[model samples]
Each structure stands twice: as structure tokens, then as C-alpha cells.
Target chain A: MSDAKLLRDELRKKYLEFGLEAMSDEEVVRLVLSLSCNEFDSFTEKLIEGFGSLKSIEDADPQALVRYSDIGERSAVLFRMVSEISRCLAVKNVKKGVYLRTTADAKSFFAPLFTDHREERLAVVCLSSRLKAVAPASVIAEGAAASVRASCRRITALALDLKADGVIIAHSHPSGKAVPSSGDCASTELLASALSRFGIALIDHIIVAADDCVSLRETDIPLSFRDRECFGYKITKLL
Target chain B: MGKGSIHSGHRDRMRSRFLTLGSGGFSEHEILELLLFYSIPRANTNETAHALIERFGSLENVLAAAPEELMTIKGIKSESAFVIRLMHDLCKRYSATSDVSADLSDDEKLEGFLTEYFSENHGNVCLLLDMTPRGELRSTKCLPTSSLLSGELGSREIAELVVRNGFVRVVIGQCIDGDKCIPDASCYSLTRLFAETLAPLGTELHDHIICCSGKCFSMRKNGSFSFGSGGNHE
Candidate 1:
């Protein structure tokens, strides 16, 4: 066999033996590109150099990927398809009936929902009394890159319709930190109080930003409604 | 109506509601009240439940509270406190026995099991899953830390554990605190090392699952890592 064929065989063998993670980014990219192009080593190097990383290449538009001399429409579309498939599978892997018992659970479930969205979006995960999710997350609102509004009435209606005992409100900060802004805090307080009146617990308000997420409940922001009495009994203040 | 009859009437109604609708139909305080009814008798458990929740901030915290701490509440005597503690213990026992024969080879099943296993666990910790040749989980052992880079638990120690227990198929799990479920370089290296070590001894390293923020990343399913010829035993 020729040198190129030998190298391809070696890469395939390593992948089967040690797995894709054992291979370098360049080797994995080259292996994928090799299926389409004969002369993929130099092309793979150029693509990596141009895109900076495999993740960036995956995130790149098909049109942008086709700008590379060696990459045709077929190759670019292949990259995009793989990325999209991975994302869909990730979202699907979030099984229903999973309990959102803690801030981390809420963050994990909501993080995947906000992936790849450049604009701000608000979603609510309705939970049963046992803290299990009643259904998948519903994107109730979408807005510009910076801000999105969450209507208390709409959220309450959805919760009532689903007969959810609790709700977790989440919104993405596409271009900003995961820290809740003043507006976010105020809106969360209002939403929490509004839901409380309906006897639906506000489990958490998560702010998802890229790969990071923060819970408003875990932060220093005090929620007054959280302290209010329930069942007609005065709450004994804890020291 | 008499005060005692009023209390008895309300208890009867609550009991009926509980039997018809189950615990999921009740609020946190209501559930606690129902549990307190058996121990506290005809007294108003609604007020006691409210007081318990208010003082502890949540029903979970109340149950987790010590018997001495529970007695601080007005109506929570020794019997009621024991009932609360009993509920907590019963939950723990139920979780432990329910999924003992779980098939770890199924990605979804493994993920669900790991999510629950690491729910109460905080910070980063390593877990070793010993499984039968048929992929049924045998037992799980939790390590001190998941930082393989720190040399806290070496591959040799894990290999020994597998050999000593005669576990033919094993899986490794780790719980990280952040939202990123993807394995880092050290994790990759550790998984590779573990697989290589176990492969020689006829032990299969099924998958290395990284549990983070309730999400599970399985190396075998993601095609990120492979071990033992990638054959399906199940």
C-alpha cells in the first residue's frame, strides 16, 4: 500500500484499539476528513489552524467551512451534520422523570436546552410534588442577545395547566456572565412570589451562560417570599 | 363542635386524601403532617408540620435533623422524632435495594443510577462499579477523590480491587461539581490507564462515566474511549 493508505490504516487501528479520545485532535479530524478527501493530512492541518480548534470547526457554519480550499460543500455539510446530531443526542439523553432536586440538577438539565443559542431564551421546567420533572423544558420566551422577559402570568398558567407542584425558571445569558442582573433578580423575586401564591414552589432560577450556570437561590440575593408563612402558621425565625 | 372532634375530623379527611392521592399530591408540610399523625395521635399535625418545615427550612432538613434537634419543636416528642428519622432511613434503604440488579451496560440506566448515586454527594469523588459478566451491577465503592492527577488512587489499587473481588466487568464513575460533563485530559489518561491495566487480567473496563450537574457522560457511548474489543456482553 502507498504511504497515505498506510497512515490511514494506522489511524483507524488506533481509533479501534484506544478509542477516539486517545487520538489527538488533528488525528481525529484527519480521520474524518480522510473519508471524503484523498489528500486530507495537509488539509486537516490547515482546517485546524484556520478554525483554531475542533470545537470551533464543529460550531462553524457550513459556508464558512467551505471557504477552505480543500473543503467542498460535502465535507462542510458532513461536519455540520455531525455537530448537529451530537447536540440532538445530548438533548435527547436528558431522560424524563428525572428529579431536579438540587441547583446542580436544574443547571444540568437547562444547560443543554440553551446550547448553541446566540440569542436570549427563557424556559421553565415544571416539576411534580416529588421534585421530578413533569415534562421537558418549555421555551416560553425568546428575545435579543442580551435580554428576555419571563411573564409571571404565562408561567403560572403553564404550571396550572401541567398541574406542576413546582417550577424552575431558566434563562440564557448569551453574551454576558451567568450572574443574575438586577432586572433578573427583581423578576425572579416577582415570579417566585407569584408562583408561591398558587402553591407552586419556585425550585430555582438558573442563569445559563455558554458552559457555566448559576442559581439565584445559591447566590446572596435574598428572596423575601421564601420566608413567608405557609398553612396559616407563622414561620419561626431560625437563628 | 368540640375542639377534639374538630382535630379528629381534619385528621380523617387528611388520611383519606393521602390514601386516594398518594404522597405526590401533598405539599412538603402536608407529607410531614401525615407522617406525624401516626406518632402524635389526634393533635393538629398541620401546625406541627408547618412548625417543623419553618424551623428546618425544608422537610428534608427536618428528617435529616438529629432526634435532639427535632425535640426543639413544640409538638415533636420522641415518638414523632423517631418517625421522622424512620422515614429518612426507609428512603435510604429503598434506594439501596431497589436497583441492586441494574444493568449498567444500558447508557440510560447507568446514567439514572449514577445521577441518584451522586445526588447527595458533594464535590468531586471517584466511584468504582463492580459488575457481573452479564453487566448486572454487583456493588459500588466510592473513592476519596476523582483527581487522578493527584495520584490519590492509582490504577494498581483499582486493579487489585477488581482482582480481589473477582469482578470480570467493571466501570468507573466520577462526579464533578460543574455543568461541564466532558472529561478532561487527566480523566482521559486515567481511563486509558485503568483499561490497559484491567485488560491484561481479563477484566473489562466497560465505561468511564463522568457525572456532572445531573448529566452523565459515558466514554463508551460517546465513542471517546473503548476497551475490551468493544464487544457487547448483554
Candidate 2:
């Protein structure tokens, strides 16, 4: 057998013996790839070279994987499956509990939304009467490289369908600071207003970036529940 | 200030009441005030709550308002605002999963539900299930660590376990391998003994399943064990 096949067999044995955490991300990718496939080693190296990290690789599209590399269609499909499985496993921890009671709970529940990323992704989690997660739906996934703009209308529609009592809107900033930009503040207000019309509370907006999370509600900023009137902050430029 | 002291006094009373009565005791403003304490630490949140309610026209509106509007109020910072938001999100998450009860008559659904507790490292589990008359799962417990992966557990130990739990209609699931759904011939030998033990107690062993990877095999479904009686044990 070729080197990749030999390595894959070894990793499989270790995975069965130890656990999923036994192998690193690239090791996982290397093991999943084919020994018989043509022009894959240099392709992996080049893909990593271009993306700079394993998370970026996982976040990229299979179309991008195929377009950027010299690998076959089947290999790209397999790579996508691996990436999807990794995400599923990451989110599985939060699925055990139906309710979230604290910002820490919200942070833990939404961690999967932030992990393995190269660009921003915005999502809204809808909650029922007891503060339990009803559905966590994606609001905007196909944003620009550095930012994502979530639509208030779409989030309101989803919360209405779930008959949600509350909503948590969140986003990831890839490898940057977790602080909300001025635009983030502006958009959140719009979304919050929209959600309020349906009597669903816009609970909090969380930004996850670089292993840290910033809760806009928990920050020392002027934005808080006690003051809900728009104080003439010239945010039109930012929005 | 006198106003600060009054607000602090009210916040303390609200918090104490909340501990005793749970969230059922608080109004929307009271709930928002309580949640804000986590983020704001030592602030008098009375005026804070009032300001928000006035601007947003209700407790939900205040909690849901944009951070910019929240910022316009004094003492309402990011930290305090986050807690309000958190309370809202927590409500949403709790509602999503609490609506469904875990009872079902379908075998496939039971199997799917049971699979949640199994993973590669944890496949050593053996579940003792108390089943309803309609084959719905009433309760399930893993036979303790002493009888875990060693496979030293016989039907006698399982019989005692079922007796202790007072379970009548039973189903057993043992994972032989982490990823393989196949059962050994030993499953039949053990299940036969289980049926034999339960027959005298007026209870029944309905099924014995071998769970592995993501699939399972049921002895009752395959007709591997005879449902006949044996009741000579003390």
C-alpha cells in the first residue's frame, strides 16, 4: 500500500483504540484522501498554502476545493463529507440540553457556529417559552470575506414560525477581535425592532472570534435593556 | 444617593423573591432587572428597567431593543445588556427541545433515540429498559460500572437489576463493538435466561438488542429466542 493508505490504516486503528481527538486536522484530511488518486499531495500542500489553516479548508466550498486543486470530484465530495461530519460532532455537545439559562450557556451552545471558519457567518437561534432552543437557523451564510449582513426580515420570519419567545443572534469574525463593529450595532437594533413586533425578545448578539467571545449585552457599552430609545447616534454612515 | 439606595434595596428584594419563587414570580421589568444584575454587577437597575420599558413600550421590547438605544441609558452597558439578551436567548433555546415527550411505539424511533448515548469510547454500555405496554421506553438505566466492558454480567445480575428498578416489560441493549451491529450467539443464551427469570415474576423480557456503530439487531425481531417459560429459580 502507498504511504497515505498506510497512514490511514494506522489512524483508523488509533481512532478505534483511543478516540477522534487522536489525530490532527491535516492528519484527518490526509487519512481521508486516496492513495491511488493522482496529484493530491501537492494539491493538499497548495490548498493549505493558500488557505493558511485547517479551519479555512473546512469552511471552503467543495467547488473551491475542486477548482483550486488538481484532485478528482470524488475526493472533493469526500472532503466535504469529512468537513460536515466534523461540524456535526462539534455541535452534538449542545444538542443534549433543550434550554440555555445564561450567557455562558448561549456561548457554549453557539460555539459550533464560530469554529472552523475563514469568513463571517451569521445565524439566529430561536427559543421557546422555557428558554430552550427551538431551532438555530442560518440567517446569512454567503456574505463577503470579512463581514456578513443578516436580514432582519428573515430572522423575524423564522422566529415567528418557531413561535419563539426569544432569539439570540450571533456571528463569527474568523481570526479577528470579537468586538462588534458599528454596523453590527446598527443591524442588531434593526433586527431587534423587527423581532419585537412579533413579541419575540431579541435576547443578545454574540460575536465569536479568535477563541474569545464578546457579548454585546454584557459589554460596558451604552447599549442595554434599560435604555431602548435611539439616542441620535449617526449610525446611518455605518449601516 | 437616596434614589440609588432605594433602587439597590428593591433589586435585593427582587433577587431574594426570585430565588424562592423561581422566574414565575417576576414581571417583565423585574426579569430584565434581575438579568441585568449579572452584567452590571452593583448598579441600581430600577430606573434602568423603567427607562427601557418606557422606550420600548413593554418588557419584551426593552430587552429586544438595539444595543445603540440601550447605550443611550445611563448604567446600561454592554455587560448588563448582554445578560438581558442572554435571558431572551435562553428562553428560545429552552422552548425548542421541551415540547416533545420521549415516548413512542415505533421500534425504529426507540433505536434512534438509544443511539444518542452510544459513541466510540462509550460502546461498553448495556441498557436495561422499562418498556410501556405499547413498547414505548418508560425508563432506561445502564447497569453500573462493575458489569461494564468486562462482559462478566450474566442474566442473573441483569434480573436483579430489573427487579431493583421494578421494571416489568423489558428490553436490553448491549454494545459488543463500537461500530459493528452484529450480535454474538451468547446474546440468545443470556436472553433465554432472562425470559426464564422474568416468567415467574409476572414480568417479561420483550427484546434483547445488540447495538454497535449506528445500528442494532433485535433478538425478538429476528426470532432468535423462544418466548417460552422457565420458573424454577428462588
Candidate 3:
């Protein structure tokens, strides 16, 4: 018998013996795509049960499916392809121009920020005239009580770059304790000063810790330096 | 043929068949498969192994997932989650307690453990262990710092613990905070101390790891705290 014929016969036998339960995730995909909508629905349900859920089947790695007794390479690849499509479809729905106005909004905004990190990160959230999010919300600097000097510069540059009317500097305490350090205070002061030079307001410096937040603007830390303008040698003016 | 020879021949055949069936082996996947062996008695776990990798995106991601999160999978029960978490525990054991159990020097064991154990904690934590090389009772504390532990851990009081406890090695590990590649200050200081304090004792101060959320980064591996573009270690 020809190779193709032999393969078909073997697959047929396995289908008869194992039912759909034994069919590979790939075969299931092929059958579903080829079938009419009603048939596809039935097959999909069967698949959901066998594989446990849509997420499991959707998230299943193709190579793993091939390890099944009757599954082959083609089946696994097709299964993975379907899941990829689902992911693309899911992400495609989110549009830009969305503004974060609340804690939930901030959480959603920062969700992607912490998705794949391995270190605690600090970012400065700059806001435009409409309080919309401007680009570059982070200033990269490190060390325990490490100076946030670089962060100040980065935040100022972001504010200037985005031409924002005001800015909120934010940093994450990956340790989950959202308390602001003295370094945070110093950095916020520096950033506020730099932003004011461009007529940008430093509205808040928020520290995000594991599960809480600390707003420095709410505290008694010095914010008046932001009002002082040192233009040159003898021109020290408090705006 | 002697009776011993006959028994040996039978054992060899069984071994070959076991190898062919790929039922028992020491491959990384096999180790992962075995992790679920206790929970899944009847089914082959190769597919589950691949499923976990696909679902989570990588092996490290799987290990990094919370046991609660892992139990959300369809086929996974509480027992399975426990088993999976145990693999991480086992790896941690290899790094922190293995040397002592093997009767190696405390300092040597600590160094070896740091290299091996800390690699698995892809998230940042400040671990305060109170145990001797011989598995003696000591104080144990775990402070999850996400990806920063340097400042909280950099105090002289902590340093004093290193000297007093005679810690042969110390690990300052972190979980990558996010796309914020700004290195964590606490992690940096903690690692610096980890290197300095453990070194003089002839104990190897292994790399302080910044676990990028799902995987780990060895400061020693990256050469410095400098993070890559879009890597979020900043």
C-alpha cells in the first residue's frame, strides 16, 4: 500500500478505536476547520472536555500534543496556530488613546509593565494638558537608597519630550512595600524642579509597592523647591 | 548459566524496554514529568509537560507560577499543584541544604547552594535563613521584595548576621519588577554585601539573581546591573 494510504488507514483505525478522545489536538483542529459551523461547534466542545478547557487547548504547545500516542507533528502545529490566532485576536481589541484616571486604570496601565520583569523598577508618569498618559513613565536607576538622579533627568526629559503640562513620578517597590525612601524624596524634588522649568507641574510622585501605594505629594516632604527658579548666577526667583 | 546471570539478563531486557518506552529518564522534561508522577498515576505526563510550557510560555514561567494559579488548569488537582511546587522546593533544597547534608563544609555548602538554589528563585526575595550546614535549627525568614532587596538587606544589622551566623554564602535575589529596566537599589546593595561578606569566609558568594518575573538573571551572568532594552530590569 502507498504511504499515504497506509497512514489514512491507520488514522481511521485509531479514530474508530479511540474515538475523538484519542485524536491529536491537530487532527481536531483540522476536522473543526473543515467542518460546517454546527459540526465545528460539536468538535470544539469535545476538544474542550478532552483537553480540559479552551484555555488549555488554546494555550497548549504543539510539540507537546505530538507526544500523545496518536498525535503527529502536523496536528500539534495546527493546534498551536489556532491558539496564536486567538491571542492575536484578544490583543487586537485594545485601542490606544485610553487614559488611566483611577487606581484600576493605573493597575491596567502598569499590568503590562510588570509582566516579564526580574527587578524592581521605577518610572515617572508624565501627564499632558488633559492628564492623559505621556510617554516614558520610568527612570532607570538602582541601589538600595540608590540616588534617583538619573531618574530625575529621565523624568524631566520625558516631560519635555511629551510636552506635558504636568507629571506624576511613579516607582515600584518590587518588594511590595510602597513606602518612599529618602532617595525617592530627593529624586521627586529634582524631577519637580526640572519639570517646572518647562512650565510643567509636578502633581504627584507616587510609589507603588507590592500591594499598596504611597503618594509623596500627600506627605510633608519639601515641594517648594519646585517653585524656586534659579535662572543664573544672581537670579534666584521663587515662582 | 548461573542463576545470577539469568536474573541479570532479565533486568537488562527490562531496562532496555523502559528506555525504549521513554518511561523513565533524566532529561529535563523527564524530571518535570516525574514531578507530576505522584499525582498522575495512570496517565502519561509528557503531554501535560508540554501543555504547561505552552500555557506559561517557558519552563521558568511554569516554576514561577503560584501554586494557586497552577491549580487553575483543568486536569490539575491540589495534589498536582503540591507536586509541582515541590520541584521548586527540591531545587531550593539543593542550593541551601544539600551541601550540609552531604557533609561538606558549611561555607563551601553555602556557596554551592547559592549558585544552585538562588538560580531557581526567578523573583526577588530577601531570605533570612537560620540553619547550619548540618541542618541545625536556625532562624528562618523570607521577605518577598519582588525584584529589590538591597536596601532592606544592606543594613549593618543584616551584615552582622552574616558574620555572627557564619553564613558561608548569601543570596540577594529579585523578581524582575516590570519593563522598568531601572535596576533595583536594594538588590544591588544586597548583592554587593553578599559578595563581600561571603568571600572572606572562603564561602562562595554566588551571583545575586534578578528573576525577570518568569526567569532569573544572574548579576554575575549579565556582568553588571545594566539591563537590556525592553528587558524591564531597569
Candidate 4:
């Protein structure tokens, strides 16, 4: 039998016998595409190698789907479309509200923004006194541009401009991990102090890496981390 | 003491705190310091974390930064920078699963699921979501307004698509510009017609949704040609 035929037969058996939940990423993709074993092995290996993992493949640009995997434009477009639709479906299922409820709320709201985004992005959501979003979350920063290194001066200025009573700041990590960096700690403090100067509360500083969002406040991070930093720029900015 | 052994105690202490309180247990700087212990080994992550926060301005910025940019930090080696990137990445990469838990299958959630497609574009969008009788989603097929207008697509056109896609149950949708999602007579008549047409092909019309922006109204929810008796409507 042809390599394609063997793959199709196995997939048919899998679907009939086990279930989709038991299938690996490569198996699912192979079953969907109906590629031969050789094609499947090569495509899966190359795609996984180029992108970080099976889950991470969806994060790659559509062009990468074609260039790296040797899939035709039509298939690449289909892959992109399917992945995008999946993300949309996930976002749609969440409860809709403007209020900053919990870290889970922030996570769902920000997940769509990081979908396959290649460069880092900074999003600032201004909130009313009730913690409801006053306006659509705005992308105040991106890539290597000036905004990426958001100055405390400008960030605070934006809060005042928006007339926001509270603000939640978020950013994407294209690199897949959502762990906060030292810079993330320093900037959140800087921005928090700057926002506080005008009595605008900083509700949270969220880190969106790949698909996960973590609010610094929700994590109950150790307080000692804050003690040492207070002696430096935060005090100067507060003054 | 060896380098790894030196930080081991602090690592265990910090890990214990993280295990107990999650982010509640540590400040943002402590969070970064804890993360750094993995990559830098013997180095003083406390000082490194502080230095990084000082250089990058905040923990959020540091995580969002590219690895190459992170490497520019004085004590951060390539290995540590990559690890930092991973720490930030692990959250989003895992959450991207979009599991659509069992509880989110209500009318509002169902419509909300369809509305996500509309939020990305403004046009007469059409979608066919195939799902099992248990309300588990199978696949979603979309026809953009650029390809075929939702209002313009006839029963035969859409019914043929249903048959071609090999689905027994299908929920259809179209996007409009305005917010008021009151399903018009045309929506009812088209769904009624589609139900009659799809009935012959052994396919069931689950729902027809009219969506605008992030809001959507379901024809099925509003009882537009209820399809209780298989594909054939008496």
C-alpha cells in the first residue's frame, strides 16, 4: 500500500477504535491532511523543529507554514484559517464583562491578542471607577520601537489622558514562557508608582506569553522583592 | 560550597513559597529572582533580578522582551536569557489549548463562540459549525462575504455545502454591521427553507445566527423553524 493509504487506514482505525483525544499532534495533522507516511514524518519533523513544539506550530506565521513545512499555499491558508478559528472559538466561550474580575478574566481577554504575534506587544486597558473597561484595550507598545520600552512618564500620561480610575497593563511574550523578567518587575513598579501619583490605581500587570496570562498581584508573589527595589527609582518617581 | 548548592536552599525556600501562595507568595521582583535561580545556577539571582528590573524598567517588560535583547543585560548569559524567555512562554503556550470546558455550551456562550469570527472582519460573513448531538463542536467552515454574501447564499448552495462537508448537524451564521440582532423575517424564512432543503439530505440545521461585532442572536434560540423531528419538518 502507498504511504498515504497506510496513514489513512490507520487514522480510520484510530477514529473508529480509540478517539481524537488519544491522537498526537502529528497524527491529527496527518489525519487531517491525508499525507503519506514519508510526507507526514518529514513535515512533522521539520515543522516541529522549526517551530518550538506541536502546540507552538500554530504560533508561527502562515508563511512559515508554507516555507518550512512545504505545504502548498492552499494548505497553509487552511491551516492558518483553522488555527485562527480555533482561537476565536476559545475566546468566544468566555464570559463578557468590562470589569476586572480575576486573573482568569484577564487571561481570556488577552489570549487572542498574542495569537501568533511574532513581536512583543504592550496593551493598556483603561478602567472606570467600577473596574469596567472604559475603552477598548489599546496597543500602546510594540516590537523594538520606542513604545516597547514604555517610559513611566508616557504611561502615566496615558492613564491621565484616558481619565482612567484604574488601569491593567499586559504584554505578550513570543518566546512561549510567561515567567516575568527582572525588567517586568522593575517596570511594573515604575508604572505602578507613576499611576499611583495621580491616585489612579494599577489593578494588575499581566504577562501574556503565548496563550497564558499571569497577573502579578494574583500570584501573591513574595513581598521582599518589593522591599529592595523601593530604595531606587520607585522612590525617586514617587517623590 | 559549589555554585548550584549555594542557591539550592534559596531555590527550595522560594519554590515552597510559590507552591503555597503562587504569585501571592512573592513580589514581582521575587518572582523574577526565583525564575533566575534556574538559569544562572550559582549567581546571585537577587542582585541579577534587581539589576534587570532596573535596566528593563519592569518584570512585564523583561518577559516580553526578545531573548537577544535580554542577553544585553550584564549578568544574563544566553542560557539564562533563554530560560527567562521560557518562563514567560510556558503560560501562554499552555493556555492556547482553548479547551471550551463542558459548562460553556449555553445559548449565550454558543452565540459568543460564533461572534469571535465576526469581530475579526466586517462583512456579510457566513459560517457552518458542525457539532455532534451532544453539543460537542466538530469543525467550523467559514465563507467570507468576499466569497459569498450570507444573505445571498441560497438553501441549495448551503445545503450542498453541508452534504459535501459530511456533517449531520450544522449551525449557520451571517454577520451584519449593527448591534440590534433581531432576526428578521428573511432570516426565519431562509432558515425554514434551509431546514426543508437540508431535510432531504439527512442533515439537520442546528442553529442560524445573525452576528454583529461581538454580539450574536441565534435563530434556534429564538425558535426559528425548530428542528425537533429529524431533517423532515412536518
TM-score on alpha carbons, each prediction: 0.36, 0.34, 0.33, 0.32
Q: TM-scores for chain A, candidates in order? A: 0.60, 0.58, 0.52, 0.52
For each candidate in the order shown, give its overall lDDT on alpha carbons: 0.66, 0.56, 0.46, 0.58
**What would the per-residue lDDT of candidate 4 be over residues B1-234, giving only the tens digit for each residue?**
776776777666665454333332345577778766545655678887888888887666777688788888788887677556543443343345433322224577677666664564334535556654435454455443322324444556666556544565667777665668877665666667667777778777777888875777776666655764264332
Ranking by lDDT: 1, 4, 2, 3
Fnat for model 1 comes to 0.00
Better of 1 and 3 by lDDT: 1
The sequence of per-residue lDDT tens digits that candidate 3 reaches over residues B204-223 is: 44445554434445665567
* TM-score for chain B considered on its own, for each of the candidates: 0.55, 0.48, 0.33, 0.48
Which model is ahead, 3 or 4, in terms of DockQ? 3
Deviating ranges (above 4 Å) for candidate 3: A1-50, A58-112, A115-118, A134-148, A225-239, B1-234
Judged by DockQ, which candidate is best? 3
Error of 1 at B127 (Å): 30
Error of 2 at A159 (Å): 0.2
Kindly provide the TM-score of model 2 when superposed on the true structure, using C-alpha atoms: 0.34
How many Å off is the CA of B93 in candidate 4?
A: 32
